[model samples]
Target chain A: MSETVLYDYWRSSASYRVRIALNLIGESYRSVPVDLLARAHRAPEHLGRNPQGLVPVLDIDGERFTQSLAIIEYLAETRPESGLLPGVAVGRQRVRALSHAIAMDIHPVCNLGVVAHVTAVAENGEAARRAWMQKFIGEGLAAFERMLDHPATGAFCHGEAPTMADICLVPQVYNARRWEVDLSACPRIVAIEARCAAIDAFARAHPDRSK
Target chain B: MSETVLYDYWRSSASYRVRIALNLIGESYRSVPVDLLARAHRAPEHLGRNPQGLVPVLDIDGERFTQSLAIIEYLAETRPESGLLPGVAVGRQRVRALSHAIAMDIHPVCNLGVVAHVTAVAENGEAARRAWMQKFIGEGLAAFERMLDHPATGAFCHGEAPTMADICLVPQVYNARRWEVDLSACPRIVAIEARCAAIDAFARAHPDRSK
Candidate 1:
């Protein structure tokens, strides 16, 4: 057995965050793919491991940790040298604010649950669903664009280094693009996503790239 | 003028999260209330502070930090003695994950935007709003109940000490109760909210009690 095993679904943004963090930290781990589309996350064994029935549970050294940002921070704190967070307290907060901007503000509203809700009640089927997605994904990406335009934003969401913010941002941008939201409006976000995609750590963690 | 000023609305759950953290850390600051109902968050000044136009922007030592969880974690880190996060790496991750369970998973879907969306589209009006609120709130609180019922839960969401998780939870529970969501199913969450409310920090920072 590997020292770490990640209970993850290939398309899950939460799981993608952990996968990128692990690669950045250079930690070797086994991937246990939990098929979310098939309701694998709600299975009895997975529920026992995580009562929340969420994917991206990181089994680290026999203990399980859930939540992508938390898992990433744990790796950063334990490894220290991987430098996912800046050394200074203020800088760390900035990084975290950017990360939460996507995780808390953007992703939650556009998740499978919200989409399903829109589809259930919306009048025109595909058009209404697409409108709902566009409104949220567009507004969220616009806000994220403003965040990236801040002087603190460099080659990455934070400074030149890749942090938890970048991990969350890339998956979100990918998802937004998948929904056919225009990226031309948010050049900063587009640039950052491109920068992140070029890296092996982020590239290797792409949903299609993962098993 | 205080070095830090918090842009908050008294009744906003997001702002309430930050207020509890500031009170817990015993930080002296100024409060700049942004009226959510009046659409003050959309104003240029507020939007400048947080492009997302959300409340609970912490203008700390001249730097502005947006997002409730981000601001709370910032305060916890800067004021280590507040004991908002655990000392060990794994413990910290668990605390953060529990906290994010509410912040990212629960709050966003039930907040103003989604509510407005439901109100705009749902033919059932008030009933639809309530249903939307209850569905997201139920899922979130049920997941939170499982986390709280874990062996790690003590008087608060985490250990005996109130951490970031409690800071996020109490406000959400308060909002849920405001909407008249049934709490009978979430004994653990209700119990933890009671434990947290008894403390002066949480009590004083309540929406009705704030300036």
Candidate 2:
């Protein structure tokens, strides 16, 4: 692939997920920051690339891609040797389910846009937003921990290796922490997050280290 | 598949998506309702089947599957002739992106749980919630329309054949209408919805027609 460019935001959980995927796959790519605070993401050119106006849009191999999970799936499908997803159909389905338990159920609800909307309407915006995050994110993780109770969950969400599940896991943990949601009830998730954090790919992809 | 069972709720957009998938593939599955309004999804037995406490859990070949998209993908992969996804790599990614633009971006924000939470926190709760649905659902469809602007789109989200994009699209339009979100700006989406509504599989899977 020639000239792979990822339009990223330093701290967007969605972008962070993609960064970890790229790092784990051992692919070198350039990052251009789209500052959400400065409204860079709302610019017409960026919207032209991704009409959703969401971050972590990847342009690679002469094509533009949106949606972090979809981008990671594309990478995994094209680079099976990277082991982003398991080979078996059932295994892939399990990983995708675990991934969606976070991506679909948690992340989208507490997204910045949603938070902004909540803030615009909520009377006690700060407390309400924090409570909202804590309730949904914490509950979602509790359910996720239950999902990890399955025999297939090992060091990572799927097996011993980090599959697409872990790619989603780390960023969500970051968001939970960012929002100050309690994770004491989710020992399995905490343990898996620790395992992912120990890896250089996930460690370096941390939003704190990003430009 | 000895006996296929779908634990479904009649009005759930997610469950509705799976019903369409099952119908399109000519898969006969018994439907068992899990009433979200009664909080049956939170019961222990249902929780055992899906820790996420979400609907549209499919039981096939003695295995349980959750997450509508994952289940659809699983069915498509294990039953490729069903053609739920496109044949090529880029095509599959595009379909997934389109699907997520609804499944993730639009649906979760407008979900009953999230909206209930929004109402509990927000002032002028009803109006705020309505605006929330209208704004996000409207913008999401507009972006989805832009996605359809590609050469690949035909009668459905991708080519003349109904793929996962169409599967997700039909229900989301159902939701937008249910919420009274205007579709005047989304001609492509409206056009696609009209086409999908005319088809037997999609028509059969409509929430209004569900048992």
Candidate 3:
């Protein structure tokens, strides 16, 4: 079989999600860092890998895949036993919904490019950027916490397994801490984060470890 | 079967995407408009449906579902003949990558609440809002157009069929036209939008028609 390659940035929430998924499935792969800080993602070579010029593009089974969640979905589908997602439609629906709440509702708003532009146009750039991150990350995580108040949510985001929802939540929580977003009201999220932190797959994929 | 109720805002891109999917599946659904302008989504009634307080919370098959894409996935999975997502992993990957390019990267960055906050913090609020929409939407679609330059793309986003990618594209194009984002360079996207516009499902789901 051909080798798997992951184009990623160590700290990107999207990239981190993929890293954890790969680890969960015990898929050993090469990590090619596309440094966002250096604008490496926008370069032509990187753009060739993904027109969207995003991180965490995976090349496996002789095909390249973009979008962290999509790539994760691809992996989950190919290796259902890995259980990145649930087997049944109802379980899948819940997992995907919880995942999107973070990946879509939270991560994108606090995306580096979007926040950079907002701060650039504001009077106090750095402070505006910090405020932007804290507000969105804090609010997004809090909503995610409320989302966890379901019978379906057990030790992880769904059932007792660490599905895609848990993979997504860990990175957002990481970002929340990075930006000092208050987690006082997000007890469920904090507990899930703590559980995920104990898992080897998640710990190996942490930004600190990867860096 | 239980009646399907869609808690939606007529103008929300996310809501509009679900509307298109329901129309495509020929599913009859009751539209309960959650007025974002009046902050109806933030009310307790809506929150009870979806803690995220987002529109397009679907009550279908006696279960409540949040997140437009996840609901669409459930619809697709339960009705595989509908072909909202492709059957194969590779096809699903491409379709999902295309979908996320718009749904995750573009739509969320231009979310109403995020824009409202960004604009409020800027000096010239209205102008900043316009520029923000144009910049993100314009760049996002341009990249999407580039993504379309692949063998998988056909009359629709993936193959000749309208999958989740097209479901996502239609609403984003609606927003682009609403915000008057320049579309000259996005010929593939423009052409796809035109094709999707010709379909009955897409036409009926149009915000103008729905409103």
Candidate 4:
């Protein structure tokens, strides 16, 4: 069989999300690190794998894929028993919404490239990066906490098992802690993060472990 | 059947994406304007519809949904013939990757709130906003144009039909023109936008017409 390979940056929230997904599926894949800090993602080699020059590009089933959430969806579609997403349409929608609440709303705003641009453009440089991270990560998680108040949210973001929502959540929580964003207002999120942290799949996918 | 309603700000790129989806699905929905400029989205009532307090909160099939891409996924799943996504897994992944290239990568960074914050922090206010818009939108669409270079890209973003990718592409092109981003570098994207603009469903969903 052709091997599954994941090209990822250890600290990228998007890459972290897909790492958890591959672990959950128990898919043994080779991990090729693309260091974002060194601007390695923009190199011709990595850009060839992804025109966007983003990480967590999985070369699987003999085809290369980009976009972490889309990669998760592809994995879920092919490996339904992995439960990366739920079965029913509404459940899947809820999962997708919860995932996007982080992937689209929070993670993108805190992206390394975006933060670098913000820091460069603003007067304070380092201070601007810190403040940018805190404001967006703090506010985005607060809204996510409210979204979790729904009855569908259980030990994980969706139900008893860790679905795509939890996969997206763990990495964002990692970012929050990295930025020292307050988690006091997010009891549900904190609890959910704690639950996901205990899982082998999620635990193995941690940035610290990956590094 | 219960009436379907879409709570959206006419000028929101995210809202515009959903408007195109609903129009494409041939699903008639009551358009409830939640004006972002007036801060209607953050109001208590709108928050009740979506705790995220974002526009393009879709109420359909008796379930209220948030996150524009997720709502489009729901529509595509329920109405497979709509072809918001492709039928095959690989094709679906391609469509989603294209959709998210804009939705997750570009749109969020240039989001009204994000840009407002950027304008506030940078030395120059309006100039910062304009520069921020032009840089991110221009670069993003350029990368998107590169993505469209694949063999899968036909008349539209993915194939002969307009999928979710096209729904995402049109609003972004509107923003590109609104920001006066140089599209001379993106002939393929420009051509695709022209095709989407001609379709009645896409035409009616334009922020101008919605207003």
Candidate 5:
């Protein structure tokens, strides 16, 4: 098998999301940690590979790619049997929509860089940043629960097996817990996270284990 | 052909993206105006169709979907000849990453709701919001310019033909121009947008025309 390499940071929900995907694909790769706090992502080498300055850029068969969802979609396409995305158009739409709720709506709004900017502008302190994260995280997940109410949602965000939606959901849930966002209203999301937790792919990809 | 309906807010970059895609596909859809100012997106009907409370919910042949990129991907898959995304895996990844640079990084951060939240906390008024948008938009476009510098970039975002990346790029450029963000640094993106502007597909999807 050809070697795959992942540029990662331990706690980034985006990076964590990609790790889960790699694990699910059963692809073993060397993980080169990008120390985000150390401002390593801003370095020239990293910028050359990914102008977005985001972590979880993957190199598979010498082809480099960035964006967690994009990388995962690439995997799903090249390695179709991974089931990263469901097969049918409607099913794929549902999974992608669910993934965006957290990835685009929730995660990006409260990204560490964004939050830092918010703090600098507002100067409202850590409590304010936490509150900001909590509010959006709560609302985003509540909406996610509504999306999951569909009959298609099973043990995962899509069906019986984990898809890209589940891969994204677990990490956002991880962020929610880290920021102490209350998940009382998102029973469906919590249940899916529980199911994902039992899977070795998800279990071994935990941020704690990534360390 | 199935009748397709797009629930849209004219000025929204996301809605604009779908409009361009629909135009590119040569598919006509009824556009239902969802007044973001009136908070119509929070209405029960809209929420039921799109739990995320965002615009550009597409209904075609009774199948409903959300997220502009996902909907575009579906259209690209179902309408293979439209060339919304490229045929090759590497090509698709490049297009998606470019789309996400604006969709996930710049757009979400400056969304109306997010900006409103910024005003509420920062209390710095419109100037602050515009500055905030400028900071991210400028940096994002600068990054996008670097992404465009690749050999893949052509008359549009990818090759000579317009793909999903151009569909996304046009609207982001629209937003950037509207927000008065300087495009001087992003020569490549500006050139692409100018080329896209001349195309009837993009012109018809203009927010002004949507009105």
Candidate 6:
């Protein structure tokens, strides 16, 4: 095994998803914290590594990989013994869709960058920012809750074990809670989050646990 | 072969992505147009198919699949003859990451719902909405341009043949251009889009070509 280094920010929900996936897969990786608040991602050094300037860039054996869901799927495929994804094609698609619903639909709407963009233009300042965050997060999460009603959902987001969907879900839930968006309407989501939190892998991968 | 019915809106970039994939695979499917302007997606029938109330739901043998990328990947896997993804693990991950770089990172930020939210709050009207759209679309397309600089980018988003990445990129670029975001900064993306557009499969699947 080669040295694995993850460029990440503690509070980035995308970074957090990758962290959970790595932890679940039992891969040992060093963390290089990127300060999102300081906009370190846009710096030249980070840009050279990832032109998109996004965190959770996984460096494995000197090769760099970006995109949290893609990194997690890479780990699942490369380290098949960890079994982060199902073997069957349809099953994999289902899991991927569930993961993407959270990654694409939910997380992107309330990201810090988007919120900041809204605040930059809105007349109401912080209140406007908060409102913008709440509206998107609320709608996205409610849609996710409806998705959870699928028969595939079990203790985790899919089936009984932790899969990529769970990896994506827990972090988004954490971020939503941080923003004070109520999750009471999403019982299935709240339940799954609790199940994920109980796992040692998820417990160790929480944002506050990292340096 | 089982009947596959696709519920899609003609103008939806996400739906356009799925159409490209379907054409690439040469799959015969019925198209059920959902009117976004009339909120047809939010109707009881469509809501049951996809609780997210989104378009591009691919119903195969009574089971409906939501999310454009997921449906595309599922089709690719089930109909392996088309081989939309690479055979090797690393190459597959690269393609997926590239697809996600656009699908997750770019599309959601400038989505119709988010833009509507911005306009509703703006009170300053169409100018504010356009500004909000331009800001996100510009940043995202520029970032996407950076991602395209990698050697992996060929005539398409991945290798010579159009894959999921190209499926995602063409529609996004089309949307960005519709919003009048300058594409001069992304010559690579423009080149890729031109290649994709030249293909009969992509041309037939384009938004303007759809019923």
- Top of the candidates by lDDT: 4
> Taking the candidates in order, what DockQ does each have?
0.80, 0.87, 0.91, 0.90, 0.78, 0.77
Candidate number with greatest DockQ: 3
**The 10-residue segment with the lowest total lDDT in model 4 chain B:** B1-10
| Candidate 1 per-residue lDDT over residues B59-175, each given as its tens digit | 886677888888787887878899999877878888998888988988988888777886777666678788888888888888888877677788877789999988889999998
In candidate 3, clashing pairs total 0
Q: Which pairs, if any, clash in model 3?
A: none
Q: List model 5's recovered fraction of native interface contacts, to 2 decimals.
A: 0.71
Q: What is the TM-score of each predicted model, taking all chains together?
A: 0.97, 0.98, 0.99, 0.99, 0.98, 0.97
lDDT of all predictions, in order shown?
0.86, 0.91, 0.92, 0.93, 0.89, 0.86
Query: Would candidate 5 be rated incorrect, acceptable, medium or high by CAPRI criteria?
Result: medium
TM-score, candidate number 2? 0.98
The better-scoring model by DockQ among 2 and 3 is 3
- List candidate 1 stretches off by more than 4 Å: none
lDDT of 3 at A47: 91
What share of the reference contacts is kept in model 6? 0.77
DockQ value for model 5: 0.78
RMSD of 1: 1.5
Better of 3 and 6 by DockQ: 3
* CAPRI-style grade of the A/B interface in model 1: medium
DockQ score for model 3, please? 0.91
Distance from true location, Cα of B148 in model 1, Å: 1.6
Model 5 misplaced regions, further than 4 Å: none
lDDT of 3 by residue, B80-127 (tens): 999999999999999888899988999999999999998888988999
Shares of reference contacts reproduced by the candidates, in order, are 0.81, 0.86, 0.87, 0.85, 0.71, 0.77
Give a tens-digit lDDT track for model 4, residues B1-211: 7789999988999999999999999999999999899999999999999999898898899998999999999999999999889999999999999999999999999999999999989998899899999999998999999999999999999999999999999999999999999999899999999999999999999999999
Q: Model 6, B41: alpha-carbon shift in Å?
A: 0.9
**Of 3 and 5, which scores higher on TM-score?**
3
Name the better of 1 and 5 by DockQ.
Answer: 1
True contacts reproduced, candidate 3: 0.87
Name the weakest run of 10 consecutive residues (lDDT summed) in model 1 chain A: A118-127
